[model samples]
Target chain A: MRSVVIAFIAGTLFGLGLTISRMIDPAKVLGFLDVAGEWDASLALVMVAALVVMSLAYRLAAGRSAPFFAEKFQVPTRRDITSRLVGGAALFGIGWGLVGLCPGPAISGLGLGLPQLAQFVLAMLAGMAIHRFWFLRKGSH
Target chain B: MHNFTPYSALIGGALIGLAAALMLLLSGRIAGVSGIVGSLLRPAWGDWGWRLAFVAGLVVAPLLVQWATDKPVSINIDSNLAVLVSAGLLVGFGTSLGSGCTSGHGVCGISRLSPRSILATVVFMAAGAATVYVMRHVVG
Candidate 1:
């Protein structure tokens, strides 16, 4: 099978998982984030389950010489803790807190044909484009 | 909270983990939604196809879910248009600058035991919690 096909299947599974778990719901995520308010602790269960499976699976994959379909695993190797990382996460957190929608859920929200989701996605794309343009101009990326 | 869904969350999360694991095993990709989307923004040679397919899959998954389970895809937006736009821009810029989001840093990176990802997750979660605190408590 082709990598694109595999990627699509993986994405489908991911989206389905999010939907079934109601992770697609912003209010639920906000509830999870809201420790001070009426907090919903169910999202933590999701994280724990996912983490357990992923950690075990990753350890197995890490030992393999190569992936079944691809030549090598392209894992993140950068280990630096730059200000950009912290600052970017802070901004992302603020946006998430405000709307309870992160990139994954936001993209999945596109399937619903809601104008509001479109608005959020377009603004997000513009933000990404602006950052890309700045980096290109500086020739630093 | 009106809806409590621990069983769904656990099953859903296990499914997500399986998906990520399959991506690693079969395609050598990190199954990070933001990272995949970000790469498509500035595509290298021969890097556009899989990313496009992945995004297409994302866009299609809800329809399939709706069909299979009779569950309408739902969201809550108490914020106005201006607030939504601002939040979108902030999330985009922040994810780009931070180099990952919940999937990349929180799930995949943490699973692999990366120090940078651990630090990133801690910072983002703390900040997210604080912001939520202020938004629900202090401001409103």
Candidate 2:
């Protein structure tokens, strides 16, 4: 129960961060990506600030044995690049470029209830389901 | 070169960092959205609370910000349904294949200096940049 509350608070903070950082705006994202043409460095600054905070947090957390709410850190063991990775990256790139919105911003953008974002989120979930059941299944067998 | 204070960006980044750290400290979780959502799909005992709360918080936080700041965002994606759907599927596929998303690997994992996450983040960012180039310049 407490963990859930904490998760909600954490998620809220994250979403708020995205909103305030102007990351939810596709134009800003595109501007940041337009390095050769215009070179909007706002997003870079955001990234740098994010990295600094994350570094400090990591430094503090590294000393701890266990998390406050959960049991252990849920890190993945697999490290090699596979077909799923290559294919997924292609898809993510296409989606992000077309819309200038990735999962984090897409999910956070839900607050605005735009139809396009809704479509993106739904399609994203459907894709996830299809990959988990169809593609991964075939690969494993 | 530009005179940008980065006040909002800094505060926001700090909040996110603090949240990620707190989640680790309290829940021992990595604050990965894909993992949290994936866990919800195949939920085990005592897993529902954090995932649900995390998702809920994501939904509500913006509303609070909008209310407070009066600077609600408006998104304009000029793509057809087919394009949007394909893109979503791709991200979904990518998240699963990579074992995490930007939040999981790019932000949190890289913070911990995990090698796998570093590779994954590089691939993800490169893929995104390449896609944007192809779509905007080449295809158009």
On TM-score, the candidate that comes out on top is 1
What is the overall TM-score of model 1 with all chains considered together? 0.96
Off by over 4 Å in 1: none
State the DockQ, from 0 to 1, for candidate 1: 0.78
lDDT of each residue in B1-140, candidate 2, tens digit only: 25243787677667777777778777777788777776665538667877888888877877887888787665667788888788887777668666777678777877777777777777777777777677767776
The Cα error of candidate 2 at residue A15, in Å, is: 0.5
lDDT of 1 by residue, B1-140 (tens): 65568899999888788878888888888988878887778859598888888787777888898998786777776778998899889888888888888888888999988888888888888888898899899998
Return the clash pairs for model 2, or none.
A68-B25, A68-B26, A69-B26, A69-B27, A70-B27
Per-residue C-alpha lDDT of model 2 across residues A47-83, encoded as one tens digit per residue:
6666677788767767877665667765555667666
- List where candidate 2 sits over 4 angstroms from the true fold: A77-83, A139-141, B1-5, B43-45
> How many clashing pairs in candidate 1?
0
CAPRI grade of model 2: medium
